[model samples]
Target: MWRIDFFLDNGYENVSMNDIVKHAGGSLATLYKHFGNKEQLFIYILEQKSEEVFGEWGRKSVCYEGRIEEFLTETGRMFLDLVTTPDAILFHRLLISIGYINDSRLNKTQIQNLMSVPVIIIANYLENEKVNGHIEVEDTYLVAEQFLNAVKGPFLFQTILGIQIDISEETRLKALKQVVTIFCRGLHVIQ
Candidate 1:
């Protein structure tokens, strides 16, 4: 797992099963049998990573049910942490860079689908929050986009454009808190 991540981080384009076999110190036959192909392996890795994050999110959200402030506070903190995490940002940048390039192994549809995972997860969380009476929004999709934009816009701009800016933990927490607060205002249920 670390080998594949390292290779991707090192800007290896068109990572193949052979590459995985050599880098991962595993047999090509075993890699093929387990993951089928490079695309499958990538998707599998993404799923594993998503599970690691969302599993904790699930537990925490459920535990903090009925308390929108606490839920959003915890969620925002965790989410900002995830967004700024080195591994998460690196993998995200790699995916964005590779997603547009034509790979012989994975087609356009598969890549598009993989890229939509984040939006899907965000929308699902917003929908769940709404159902739990945490926030009231007419459109979860748009709300999800806004939520993502609030969190990702600055980080991605700096990352992709090489804009040097001091990003402190305190700044991240403040940004996250503001995003949640503004979003909650827009989504608050009318009494």
Candidate 2:
């Protein structure tokens, strides 16, 4: 928790093994012995936080009284709630900060791949839906990515960048309906 806390509170570039060890109550040798280096430690923390943040969504069931709109609405609402969270925003900003540091040894693509749990979840759902003739998409993965990016991009970006932190429930619901409707229409959903 301390390792994640340190990195999220202080930008990734500003934190050090010493700072972590100091705050986490561990010796530098032990930290090095366990994590090997700062990069590994950061990666470990990133993976841990990623799992913690996304695990619940991954566990979300696609079942919603057999309604695709209901499933999509739930997913979109969850995504909106997830990204607007303070912890999530800080985590996202940490990633953004890492992007500007060349010496971090972890590239943007690496982080993106690591953080692709939502895309995987969506793709699997879309693939299942397509098989059942509930939707039609040439490529489930690409369509899933497009849906996720389009659905969550604006409000997420606004809150994350401090442009607008408190999106009203009415606004979120409206956005969810619009995104889900557009996505379903694009996919040529049968229902």
Best by TM-score: 2
Tens-place lDDT per residue, model 1, 99-138, is: 6666544454765665555556556766777787766778
How high is the lDDT of residue 157 in model 2? Answer: 78
Q: TM-scores for all candidates?
A: 0.81, 0.88
Q: Pull out the clashing pairs in model 1.
A: none
Residue range 60-101, candidate 2, lDDT tens digits: 745653467777778888877877778888988888888877
Candidate 1 lDDT for residue 157: 60
TM-score of 1: 0.81
